[model samples]
Target: MKSKAAIMKTSGKIELGRRRAVWELPAELANLHHKVSIGSSCFLKLAPRPSKHWDARRAAELAVGAGFTLDKPCFFRSQIAFLSVTKIESLPDSVGPKMQTLMVGLNPSPYSSASRVPYGRPGNRFWPAAHRAGLISKDRDIHHALVHHGIGFTDLVRRTTRRAGEIDPPEFRSGFERVKSLIEWLKPKVVCFVGLSGWRIVSNPKAKAGIQPASIGLTTVYVMPHPSGLNAHASLKDLIGH
Candidate 1:
């Protein structure tokens, strides 16, 4: 008896000898070219002659040489099925309408991301400086910052990184666009970017620590020093002064 694979090849069900091979539908052999399923895989329950009705014997025979079983009371189609999918969550921005000031960060740090809070990293001086400057209450709560002082927080990039150096130019571009959109939407009175580099990414590279000439709709922009423990350009006092 011929091998089932050989029989399939010899029967001209699928081209096998040429450089490029294709399946030959039964409709094509039967001159039923008008059928849209001619070039595509059609659902055939069973039997070599698709016009013939499906039965147990044909399914068993087809299953003998084929990799898959065409079960009884089931349809067969030539398509792979995806079994599972996953979605990723991004960090949330702390912001609201008509805020007095919005503090923008370069990106979330690993510590802040883990705690689901901005500038929550233990060694970071952002919270302390903000408190000292009367921009935040003694409490570390974001709600207190927003409700009491009208100070909101956001980031150029939502993704966390160990260091700002790890972020690429593409991330900077995306972050700048997001912040611009936020400014246009929220219309904060004053937008204070907590990092000069991040603000520069959104504006002129020569941007200083003071006010920026560019405005987002009616909002004004300002740049400040990054409060990371590693940033050595200014003392916390000098950062607050800026």
Candidate 2:
């Protein structure tokens, strides 16, 4: 039988509430410790243990390979999402400050951590369109643009799970306060919310469904579809038009 401490060393490092831990696995399936964990941003889950076959090393490798820290384990039982306890990091201070376009997203995803880049997911199209739309200039280096192009990225919610919809209204409302504080302090020209959810949550408390671009305080807010491949029906042109 594998000891829990042994499993800890083999699991991928993950941040969890002021500390970190290795992802847990069933003691019964300890032989084949080399398999990948699976799931999306809202509800990542492990694959079924294959007939007494799974080992910590395999789990760690899979978690690392799949762009996740083992400590941030995601599990699903009866189709309900279960995320292991973990600490959510504060958004970078650099994400604030004067900008022409502030691109607000729902939250970070697992892949974002792996790449160490925001909006880095292959399926997410926010980067390409934002670049094409003149919001992000080709002439400017990434660091410069982040500081000067008046471009910054933030989220309506800061927590990252397998999916964005997992966030509730209160979470959205709380996120709005943080975003509002950023805007008040940063003083950007235009805040381009990446999706309708952001626009609603950040712009108007009464907003339930969706609404068009509206100004809030000194900032102008614009809404666009989320850039996930799920929005394939929508075109990059549509976002640029906003």
Candidate 3:
């Protein structure tokens, strides 16, 4: 009997025997040639290097954010290891014209990024509250909400973080401008911000929850409490109500 040899290829390279792989990034990716090591356990480990512009840990993030499907990297001891590469870190905007409402979140959490779903973190009350509020026909179904309920989803910032507090005010300001342009173009009936902190910094410092006087073109603006489980300020009931 003869043993079988297996070979696999992805967007990057896998060098046999050498236990090293180099990602052939496109020119638009700033010509990054990130290297990784294939361990005996069949895990891809990022090879550390000193670079002022690029960080090894962020290589996978950048790839996923650029619409590449890749496995997320995890920390193994002191080294960063990837089980596979096939998901995105940044959630894409799911808005379309004639949308009844556009739900804007603060940013993508690491959990949500790995799951490839907006507000997908298990502890996050967004889906549950939206379901209870009759905003979506199916729980955690973004497509169903958009198609059936006219509810769209987007984020103020596409960056993924463990906590929303990590996002800077400048990011919020810039993100708001982008959202404003989107609203102006899509012309959604209502723009609902799922986090008050972002709206407060971008639009009004003392902005309160609910419908605001501000309007992006003809779209109404509404501020809601953050649906994060860590946000004790607003309960699930309060989120549903908002």
Top of the candidates by TM-score: 3
lDDT of 1 by residue, 1-242 (tens): 01122212223233211221111221121121112231233233222333222233323222211212222333333321111111112234555554899888887776775465678888778888887877777556775677678787777766567788899878787667757766765688998888888877767888888888888889898888888888888788986676
Residue-by-residue lDDT tens digits, candidate 2, 1-242: 22232322114332211111222332212211212233322222343334222333334333332233335544534322233322233122124334676677777676764444566778677767767877676532334567557676666665466677788878777766666655654577777667666556655544432234456668766666777777775777876665
Residue 219 in model 1: shift from native, Å? 0.8
- Residue ranges of candidate 3 with Cα displaced over 4 Å: 1-88
TM-scores vs. true structure, each candidate: 0.62, 0.56, 0.64
Candidate 3 per-residue lDDT, tens place, 1-242, comes to: 01121223444632121122222121122111112211212233343332332244344443433333444554433333343443235555555455999998888777765565788878889889988988887987766787789888777777678878898999888777767766776689999998888889898999999999989999999999988888899999999898
Point to the candidate with the largest lDDT.
Answer: 3
Model 3 vs. true fold: TM: 0.64
Give the Cα lDDT of each candidate. 0.56, 0.50, 0.63
**Which scores greater on lDDT, model 1 or model 3?**
3
TM-score of 1: 0.62
Candidate RMSDs in order: 22.5, 14.2, 12.4
